[model samples]
Target: MSSFDAEALERAAKAARELESSKHVKAAVELSKREQNVKVREYDARKAEASADAEKAKAAQIQIAAEERRKTIAFERKAKEELMSRQQQMERQRMREQDQLSRQREQDMLEAKKQADMERDARRLQMEQQIQEERLEGARRRAEAERANIRARAMAEAEGRILEQRKNEDIHARDIQRRSEAKAAELRGAIQEAFSQLSSTLGSYIKDSTALRNTVFVGTALAVGVYGVREGSRVIGRVVERRLLTPALVRETSRTAGTFGLRQRMKRALGMLPAEEVGLDGIVLEDKLSSRIVETASATTNTRRNGAPFRHMLFYGPPGTGKTMVAKRLARTSGLDYAVMSGGDIGPLGKDGVTELHKLLDWGETSKRGLLLFIDEADAFLSSRSRSAMSEDHRNALNALLYRTGEASRSLMLVLATNRPGDLDAAVTDRVDDAVLFGLPDAAGREALVRVYFEKFVVRAGEDAPRRLMGLLPAARASKIEIGEGFTDEYFAELAARTAGFSGRAISKLMLGVQGAVYGRGEPTLTLEIMEDVVQRKLAEFDERRRLAKTDYTDSASEAVTGTAADAAARRSSA
Candidate 1:
């Protein structure tokens, strides 16, 4: 009962209290853990519900976007189909318009062709009627001429009979009155003697009476005698003239005859004679000559500080190289008087003939303020004197030419054209102020010449006919062809080409042949086929001439070679 017992009771009670507290803490902790678990389960359920709703909304949005895309695609496809249909309609409309235009054009062309045919028929009928009328008129005129000639012959016969009867009566009367007629007979004899003396003196002064008469004659006579002399005697005379005449003769003749001398006569005849005025275009001469001529002409026209006349020029070339044409053009462009003559005509003058030549020179020097003398074939008159047998007449003629060439006057200009420059006298060559050599044309020139001919035919055929024919011509030729304003250029280049190796004279013959063809065809439009045929014929003629020339050349060459060989053999034998 004591202090120890009370201490044990207290310890036991304390132990009980401590045990209860520990149990209560354990219970509270367990309760709190259970509440936390319940809160976690509730949060999981709410998260599951939110996830399902979000999934459903997302599916709805996907379906709406798909529907919108499908609608847009359908609209685009409709628009493309509508555009294609509109394009097809427009194409059909354009095609229909083109067909209508094409038909209209065809109709117009047909109508035009019909009109052209009608016009052509009308023109043909008119031409035929005119030709018929002309033939009838010509026949009537020829009949009238025959009747007139018959009447003239009858009148002449009657007059002749009357004259014969009167002559017989006069003879009978003279016998009866012999004493009275004695004085008249003596006077007549004296007159006859004087006339005979005068004739003899004139004969001595003139080498040939025939030459003097021919020189004085003009127009047809001059042309025929100078240019158309085919007789042997005339040819011989021409050769002799080339060897004998002096250049001074022209001056002397002019002085002796005064104003009425040979020079004046020639000038008058040239002026009065009817000439065809032809217009030339695109006439390009050989380069050397063309350049020289153009330069000379330009210089002449140009004004200088020191006043001086233009320098003169000479043209040297093979025959038919257009030297004469250049000279003529120079004179025409410069507004100067032109006097043309042949070397053969100038060189053949005898002492008596000199007077006429001199007169011509004087007229050129005095009357023509600006005069140009064109001497064609000048080499014939001014041949090399070194190999020539000297004659008094020949020496004098050479001296005269030298004097004229050296002495330049404001009024006088000389232009000499020669084919054989080697034959020209040394003095004459030295005196020439300017010299231009003409050679064969180049390829370009030939092409141009062909074009010129085509153009010429077109112009001659006229509008409608030429137009129709032009379509048929070669495109190459048609593109290049150009017609001159007038007839000057004509078809000379083509004619010249056709007459290759031919002289100017021969070329003229070829042209005449072409004209003959045209006439034969009754002046119809010269179609391409017709032109080609004409060209072929011309070529055939040219070939024949070439063959003849070749034959002659070969023969001459063989003869020369044979002669040389013989001479060499003879020399060897002598050695």
Candidate 2:
């Protein structure tokens, strides 16, 4: 029963347990085969013992013992051989795993070297790019320095030449002064001699004709007084023109094209200063279309494919929606020289309209500053040529416009504004680069316009700004129309909301009406009720105008239909 015996099942079971714990599947399988072989040998031993007993022969028993010994030796040899074979196979497998691990490590090392080389090459390229950039920057700086030095030298030379010319001018001026004084003295002597002769003749007339002497004396005295007055007025006129008008015009001119044309001076007299007209601010930008057009024009003014600015644009919208205002802003924000003319003004010139239109285009081109020619109510003259009512005058003007608007001149932009875009000739629309629509303001726009009008017309222009900007005054100026304290931005917003269909002009007019109503009554401040009453009146007026326009359109269409039917009947009767 000792486990030391080869036939013990406990010994085989211990070996099997050890093999399972070792977790070598191949070794476990070989142990299981050996266990089966042992079972077969035990069975063979039992069978041989049974056969010996059945025969009851001693020789047979002895033979069976010898055979069993031989089989034990063979079984021992086979087990030893299998153990050696399993050990050799395990050794070979372990070496293969070690070799695979070593190869993996070598591959990882090689990949690391490749990544390091790539990083080094990238760093080298980056350093080279930096060095090249530095060199280019240094070269640009040196070139700028050289240009500045050259400009300095040229300016110095110009200044020296200017100084020499000024000295020469001074000497020439002195010579001219001497000659002028001499001529003045000679003229004075001649005037004295002529006056003495005239006095002698008048005295003889008095002595010879006593009846007419008093009348002649009075006439001579009156003539001398009139002559003195005329000369004095002439001198004053020259002084006023030189001292007052010239400097005033010069100051105003500095803001414009450096000098004023006669027409521009006339325009200034009519209270249309270009700078003031284009000086609108945030409130004017409440309309999205207007602001977008203004912003687009300003942004693209200096854009370049190769090189070019914004070309021509068309502004079409309802009346009082600020087409002309947007055009002026576009011209101003782009810093272009602005010229304004109306199509209505041009149409009255008959055949001369074409000439005047060409003159305008020529003037714009002649001024080196870029020109923005804005024509308001353009449909008046730019009407379709195919229309029955197209006058010869408008036809000629349109032809000239087509010629001038071919390709925009150097930095010249033509802006046309029309309340009736459908009336505009196809040729005009085709020449225009961009057309922006400006419709009536919505709620926000109305409120902004109201605020702008109130602030501009009532607050600032009236007397209230004195209190707001410089603290409360002792008394308002006599000319000031004071704004009531109750009328605030909220009041304006409410009034604006009520004014649903009113244009900007109508809102401004409402302000004007309130001012008139308040000022005529001699009230120092305007009440909110007064403002509301004025707004109601304006709204009524606006409604009336709309109704009239609709009625007029309906009447005209019906008349056209009636006239056409009558004409057709007349033609049938004639047939």
Candidate 3:
């Protein structure tokens, strides 16, 4: 409390003490209490009066708020009515404007139609005037042409009269010349008759003499005999050379029996023939090797077309690796006649090998289309001269070949295939312009080969209506061969994995064995079991051959060492 309130409280306390001390203290205290009570009642009356004033002010604010809300509603209603009146007016204006536009479009269409009709009439009038002008021009041209034709006819008549006069003069001169020639001919004929009579008398006199007749007959007979003998000998020699000398040397050839002439041209045009110098589909090989062959074939074909000398090639690899096949195919693809010869045949010719070799080359040169001379197993005869086994005759034969092929030839392309390239003489290898290695088929190549042979010997060969395959298979025995569905690409892949180090030819043989086993069992169906059996047998055979080959090689090596040791002992003893 403030200081004033504390003072009042102290005074009240003093008064109460005084009242207690005085005899009228009770009345004084009571009067003081009454005054305090009266003050409290007055304070309460003031608070009540303030509350009543606050309530009146609150009621006045509520009345004012209700009036304001009612005015706001009235204002919103008026604004809404105004907005509706403006929207209705705008809608009516849009409808009137649209009607005006429609009327304007109809009027425009009518105007455009009227304009089009006017333009069409003008165009028709213009066209009629132009046609009339063209007709007048044509009439003027026709009249001029008639005049020109009459002038030309008059000129031609004048020229004809002049030419007729000249022809008459020429004819008179020719007649006079012919009369003179006839007279001269008469004189000549008289002289010729006299000479003919004189010659006839001499011929008659000679015919009457027996001695002259006999001499003439003998001379004629001798001449006829000598000429006949010479010509006969030449013809016989050529026949013998071609028929006997070269036939033994040649192992195979498509030169004599091949697609040729019009038939070959027709087949080529129809896309029936193989691609030209691009790839060989007849034989299968790795892509890289195949591409190289295609390049070589293309080059060879281009060289031939350009009249360049043929390039000699060497194909050296393991046996049955398609060396011979590739050579033959390349020759055909390059438009050259193919001739396959075995080098082994040359060694047996001995002293006559040179003559036979020459004959073969001469015959090859006779091919109208150039020849591709493929020598298989070339090392058989063309081995290194340094070897002791090379006899004089063989050396002579090799020399003959070297001399013949010393220079590039346009008529003959030499392709030598050998299992042992190292054994070839340097001279022989030197003649080669290109060399290719035919390796054993890899997994992919073997798989492809298996698929091919399977299709050929197993599938096609078992067909009911088997046809000739490029004249390779002449006849087919139709067998009801049933192959299992399980025999798929995976099976072939597995077979390829099993047949490691197999050559293409070996795979073909393996398939052929599968066919044989099926036929031998008298079963129409060829199952996986039968094929596996044949494969196993073929594998065993192949292993046995490999083992024998290794054994033979080892034995030869040991013998050579032993022989060298023995020779050294003998030399030491001699010393």
The candidate that achieves the highest TM-score relative to the unseen native structure? 3
The C-alpha lDDT values of all candidates are: 0.60, 0.69, 0.81
- Candidate 3 segments whose C-alpha is farther than 4 A from its true place: 1-216, 219-227, 230-247, 257-278, 462-476, 550-575
Error of 1 at 29 (Å): 52
lDDT of candidate 3 over 428-512, digit per residue (tens)? 7767766777888899989999998999888877443423544344355667577776798788899999999788989989988
RMSD of each: 21.4, 35.9, 34.1
By summed lDDT, which 10 consecutive residues of candidate 3 come out lowest? 551-560
Q: In candidate 2, which residue ranges exceed 4 Å CA deviation?
A: 1-280, 303-309, 462-478, 488-490, 550-575
Q: What is the Å distance of residue 402 in model 2 from its true position?
A: 0.3
- Which structure is stronger by lDDT: 2 or 3? 3
Higher-scoring candidate on lDDT, 1 or 2: 2
Ranking by lDDT: 3, 2, 1
The 10-residue segment with the lowest total lDDT in model 1? 474-483
RMSD of 1: 21.4
Q: For residues 1-575, could you state the per-residue lDDT of candidate 1 as single tens digits? A: 64568888999999878867785867876888988888788888878888888898888889888989998898899898889888988898889889888988897887697579768988998999899989989988998999899999999999999889787997878786996689789999999999999999788769787777766675668668766666767878744443333244232211223334565455444543223222233565656556767767656545121235434456775566678776766665555556677777654665544555555565565533366778787876777778556455666766776666554456667788876665666667555666666665554565455455444444433322221232343222222223223334444455455545554333444444544455466443344445555666677777886777552112332233334434543544475
The TM-score between candidate 2 and the true structure equals: 0.46
Q: Return the TM-score for candidate 1, rounded to 2 decimals.
A: 0.42
